[model samples]
Target: MLSRVAPWLASRNENGLGVRVLGGADTLALRALANEDAVANVFILAHLESTGTAAPTSGGASVFGVFDGDTLLGACWAGANLVPVQLEPGLAGYVANAAHQTGRRYASIFGPAETVLALYSRFEQLGHLAHEVRADQPLLSISGGPAIGANPDLSFGSMADFDRILPACAAMFEEEVGYSPFLGGQEFYSKRVAGLIRQGHSLVHIDAQGTVIFKAELGAVTRDVTQVQGVWMNPELRGRGQSAGYMAAVVNLSRTFAPVTSLYVNDYNTKARATYERVGFEQVGTFATVLF
Candidate 1:
């Protein structure tokens, strides 16, 4: 848990209306704020539920909160990526300012479209330029069974499939992010994949030859929602009209962890968007990502 005595990053009036590192005492307030939009805030909420606000994660990640006097209003998870929770566009500047003061370089800033763009604008003014900005990613969710038939072969991944799953995950990451996740070192990325598999979060379909056919992970999970991510299909199978069935399976499997299954996708990816629609997902909100 974060220390209550942790120095304030940005203090305002005596009533404490400013951005600062959240401590264990602020857990309830933070949860209340994040739960306001559970589906959209699942990533941060999952982290909080699993790790608490006691101390930073092994990756030096911490939750930063914005307050209006003593009442908590918004939060951002400062980690590999910046995930804003219930943050208004107007308040993003304050969070961005506080984040910038830490002198940390983030892989990306992502969340509700307005807030993310607002935060990115602040960072831009501070001389931080992005390699790419996905300004309009649709956040889609499904609460009921998928419309398409689920692929029976798709199932939770295990260590026995780790070798195949790891490389496939890396390929998806590189193709999406424009850089290899293994650029820094493969150890960290490998551990993340293994960890997800160990938690039963990795979902995959591997062929007899040990090739990953379809893969996706329940990246963020809470009792109410689970966000699907790292969705991928074998290149040889593209345009074979197979994504819907696989995605239907993802939706079905995801329900074992949470009632709602959710994922966000780039606006330009019309094919993937259509596949999700075919699987019964409905657009719930918009998200944006500014890759650094």
Candidate 2:
């Protein structure tokens, strides 16, 4: 069986549509295909742009590719967060066999549903466990939409707002992922918050006491797409019916940075989905996530 399965072996370049870990020499090929589906590939592209195929010393992350005789066909990035980013399909078996040896066990696997599912199924067939599978997330996008509404209090977050925004960010992460992001350690997460604030990527609405009531971050921006993430509202404020208006405000603010604003949400998130619809986002594709 080992001999028969050798064609898809990873970490080395081989003949035909084989699997191998990518390196600096593969940068141009990887970047071309990653940009071909920029929104879906942003996580990997963001890494590739910074490190350019050089494996980082501390990030505990690596990118792998499936090549058709050295021509790239697909790639996947496994990183410190454990959310393996699926960039293309047609290499499920390759990813399945390569996951553990290429990187540590992950928290989740996410991407376009069809590809994510294909990879997850193959991965699990080899005995990995999935704590949850969000198999039908709607990938939404907006461009040239109707004018967005405004909220007097909703505005971009700054260094001044960092302390106030961090708790809300932690709350949102816990609620969405079933655990506090602070579990690992405060320093890494804290640095992430500060970095986003410094870059003007965070937005929030604060009250008189400087409590953050609404928060979101511009998570990724590339020439082809921009993504919004970490959206949250103070739980006590819910059912007062303010989310729709504030979300629209974000949509308007978002377009200034990129012509297209995109995000993916679990299919069961009816309220969030409705708010996005009201804000002019349309479901352009489906995504899936497997949480471990």
Candidate 3:
């Protein structure tokens, strides 16, 4: 593994560049930037927060960076059992070599559309398949306007509600998000959900009937920017003009935490795009998700 990375590592040195695990005082600054940049990026940054907390099982996760003297040029981090974040412009060759050196099969990645295409091409040449593409875009706006409709009873979900809501949560994730960790069993799923909630990074909306309709996994509360993620609405309640209301309420509530807030929508999800637009979110940039 070291042998495979040697030449590339040497090349970086020749350019007065070095790559290693992130460290020191700037860790907080880097983490803040990643949170502002993107929520997924923030989640990756969370891994760097090993302050008395158990390091998340790398499972298939790792972070690397490219630096020139005191300047950080780029960095990448893959989540446990998920695709890695590819933040650099042209380091696909080095990435692939490193992956092979580590004896991994393939790496999942997501970022700007063009970057994904480039990495996909590079990975394909190395016999890896970048078979699935999830087209999504970061939607952002300064939140302070009146909501479009009546506010539903909304609150953060409690841990005790997990048993009743877990199945629905799993189904919504599998259907809309196209992934389900619970397929392994309730244990893995429970722990993952608990970890997210314990981080105080998720929001839930329940109707008067006490049903979970809309939920979003949010990132850390930092700066004036709050990030919305893993948004889900009950499938049976789609097209009732409710999504707009839910989004508006979430945004309105988020303002108490941060001045700026953002979320991502699948490019192919016109309905969601329209709903979000109705609530005042503007398209920032496109992101590509490569499923391995």
Cα lDDT listed for each candidate: 0.89, 0.74, 0.60
Work out the TM-score per prediction.
0.93, 0.87, 0.78
Q: Write the per-residue lDDT of candidate 3 for residues 1-49, one digit (tens) a residue.
A: 1113212345666878765545554465455455555544534544554
lDDT of 3: 0.60
Candidate 1, run of 10 with poorest lDDT: 1-10
Question: What is the C-alpha RMSD, rounded to one decimal, of candidate 2?
Answer: 4.2
Candidate 3 ranges beyond 4 A from true positions: 1-14, 24-41, 44-61, 81-86, 105-107, 135-141, 145-147, 177-179, 207-210, 219-221
The per-candidate count of clashes, in order, stands at 5, 0, 2
On the 0 to 100 scale, the lDDT of residue 199 in model 1 is: 98
Report the Cα lDDT for residue 14, model 3. Answer: 80
How much is 78 displaced in model 2, in angstroms?
1.4
lDDT per residue as tens, model 1, 7-36: 233434355678888888988888889889
Off by over 4 Å in 2: 1-15, 50-58, 81-89, 145-147
**10 residues in a row with least lDDT, candidate 2:** 1-10
Clashing pairs in 1: 1-53, 1-54, 1-55, 2-53, 2-54
